[model samples]
Target: MTLTLSHIKKTFNGFTALDDVTLTAPQNQTTVILGPSGSGKSTLLRCANLLEKPDSGTLTIDEESIGFPARLSAGQIRKIRALSSMVFQSFNLFPNLSVIDNITLGPVRVNGQSKQEAQDAAKSLLDKVGLADKADAYPLQLSGGQQQRVAIARALAMNPRYLLFDEPTSALDPELEHEVTKVMAALSAEDASLVVVTHNLRFARKTADKIVFLEHGNIRFDGPADAFFDSDDPRIRQFLSIYDD
Candidate 1:
């Protein structure tokens, strides 16, 4: 399994955010976490990378259990985070840095890769994301969609084993949203092992091998995309119905 979460539970200030959520995602398969707002989709992604600590449960990547970093050293948590790269809804890029610098920054700083080596890798990633020409442009100069694509390129620069997306297209206008989605679709097609928490149901349907529904901080449904499309479950049908109307 590429990822396994067992009895995962998280709470904040006496409120339960996630309760006993369990899931297993296969390697090279796109798994989209679907849910309404505040359904713990983003929380799940955050917990997976140790960005948000789970109150209880085990998270395993590639069958190896992850030790909760709150109990471990800071360096240990960074290592785990490095193994998985997250793309957020907001394009989190340095306004002062050029696109190329944004992409190469982390690998150089955290991985301690030489500047020349990081640049070579960043160039290849930029080409993959169709942003090679925008290398010198700062984040503020690019459109929202372009900045998000640069974020993807930056994540890829780390050469992570898994990719996590948290509402990656939520902040874009319709036209710009399409641009980002097209790039994401292409990437998912090339490598299916992507975990995305998104409200884009169409992208979930088209790109995901498995669709897991979360409601009230719990896994309401987990099955193949076809089942989700068919939506035999009452809750799944009701949840999906919102989009139709």
Candidate 2:
């Protein structure tokens, strides 16, 4: 299984955010998108799940192309979304809901899963994210990391073929960041296909099977994580300086 985006181009008021961006993410591995701010990393990740429609592109899951620009029927759009679930950096939990409730809402509402069915699956995901005890806790009661893990669990509850992360650890403190990355590391070991947009170079190096670098709304490098680090590209070298490494 794979997720492929080809010839993707997006513009708002004619300001291109992604220009001819093409990426292929194969199954059972992690692909990281790296770039400085305004380099279009988030936009690219958003397009993968149709959260942001590409002005022109062919997004395919497995082998079927789902055109972003085409006026897709509701069913087609739902089918497209079902194939990938997005995890945001902010956690995006409902403040009024308990952790379990937040995780179960999507499956129960969007997937038409009964409450019991959703809860059953959510319990397993809770354990997987090390949040089995936080199920009944409100988002306000949890740390940023715990809340983010709940978000990850919420995405996993859908049992999607791919999980797309938009800088999942960006909002957490370094200690808290470890909590989220640990969960992601466990996910990477499974059959899950992950496409992450992140500025955390250390985490990217640790979890990424493949690294893709973007610059000025264009992709500059695509290769193994180690190779990307060893690249002669000055732009990539400059990124290393941004962090303490």
Candidate 3:
């Protein structure tokens, strides 16, 4: 397993977000977390990255447990975080900074790489996402799709082992959304380990190697993408019906 969530549980003010959720995300494959609103899909993804701390249970990266002030040193925790990159629903690019700056910030600040080295890396990543020409353009100057592509480039600049995408295309227009999806598809093609939280069933079916349907904080089904849509389980069937053809 590239990532494992064992008995992971989290709650906020007595409202449970994740209920003893257990998952084994395979390496070199896209594993999707799919569910309706309030299904704890985003929460689960946040927990894996320690963005939201779970009340109980363990999160392991390649079999090594990690968290704040427990099972890992501060430096080790930072390193672990660097090993995984996350792209949010909203493009979290630095509005004031140019595209290249947004991509170079992490390597220069977190990893202590020289500005020249970071710039070179960021440039390559921007090119990979088809934004090399927009290097000097500010985030506000770009289109929604362009900003999201830059966000993807920023995450890749970190050289992470795995990538987590949380509704990466939800904020774009249909045409722009298609562009972002193509970038995501390209990432999955190049790197097998990609974890995503999305409501796009077409994306789930086309890109996911395994799909885990989440409901009320519990996993209702964990199987191949086709099996999930074709599941005999009534809950799975009913839930999918909302998005089914």
Candidate 4:
């Protein structure tokens, strides 16, 4: 089982964001996408989740394949989206709703789980993410880390086949970021199928099973995490130099 993007290309107006990018994220492994800013890392992740449809490409999740630049019905779109859950850099929680309500909304509404069932699942996810006691609190009441944890829990409540995180801790300080990254590390250890886009080298080194590095809308390297870090390629070496302490 895998999520595969074949010969994917995307452009905005006159600028190319991704050019003939082909990648496959296998099940039960953490695939980390790394690149400098505006190197098409986020765009690639968005395309995989169908948030930004590729101008030309085919996205295949397991056995089902959807080719872009073709009309897709609402149900078809929903089916594609249901295969994965995404947590954005910003915690996109509903401020008006309580934490528990926010987590349960998707399962209860989209997945058609009963309210009680959704709540039970949400609570279990909350406990797993160390937010069990804050279920009744509002998003505004939580810190950046807490809110992001809630977002992670919200994503998990869907029981998606893949979890996509786009710079999940980019908005927090180091201490707060650790709180969220700890949860992610635990998930990676559990062998959850994860695709993460981040500049956090430490987390990538520790958690990534595979690494795909992009540069100027092209893939610079795709290999095991150890090989990526130990690469002799000048582009990758320069990129890694920036994060070297």
The Cα local distance difference test for each model comes to: 0.86, 0.89, 0.86, 0.94
Higher-lDDT candidate of 1 and 2 = 2
- Residue 132 of candidate 2: its Cα lDDT? 90
Using TM-score as the yardstick, the better of models 2 and 4 is 4
Candidate 2: which stretches are off by over 4 Å? none
Q: Which candidate has the highest TM-score of all?
A: 4
lDDT of 1 by residue, 14-80 (tens): 8888999998877888899998998999999998888898888888886347644348678767777
- TM-score per candidate, chains pooled: 0.95, 0.95, 0.94, 0.99
Candidate 3 has an lDDT of 0.86
Write the residue-wise lDDT of candidate 3 on 44-114 in tens digits.
99988888878888888864685433555577668668878999999999898989999999989998989
Clashing pairs in 2: none
Clashing pairs in 1: 28-192, 28-193, 29-192, 29-193
Q: Model 2 lDDT vs. the true structure?
A: 0.89
| Model 2 C-alpha lDDT per residue in residues 1-245, reported as the tens digit of each score | 78999999999797989999999888889999998889899999898888888999899996557776888778877887888999998888999999999999989989999999999999999999998998899999999999999999999999889999999998888999999999998899775799999888888878899999888889999889999988888877878778524
Q: Which 10-residue span in candidate 4 carries the lowest summed lDDT?
A: 62-71
Error in Å for residue 93 of model 1: 0.5
How would you encode candidate 4's per-residue C-alpha lDDT over 34-135 as one tens digit per residue? 999999999999998888999998999966798888788888778877899999999999999999999999998899999999999999999999999998
Give the CA lDDT, 0 to 100, for residue 40 in model 2: 92
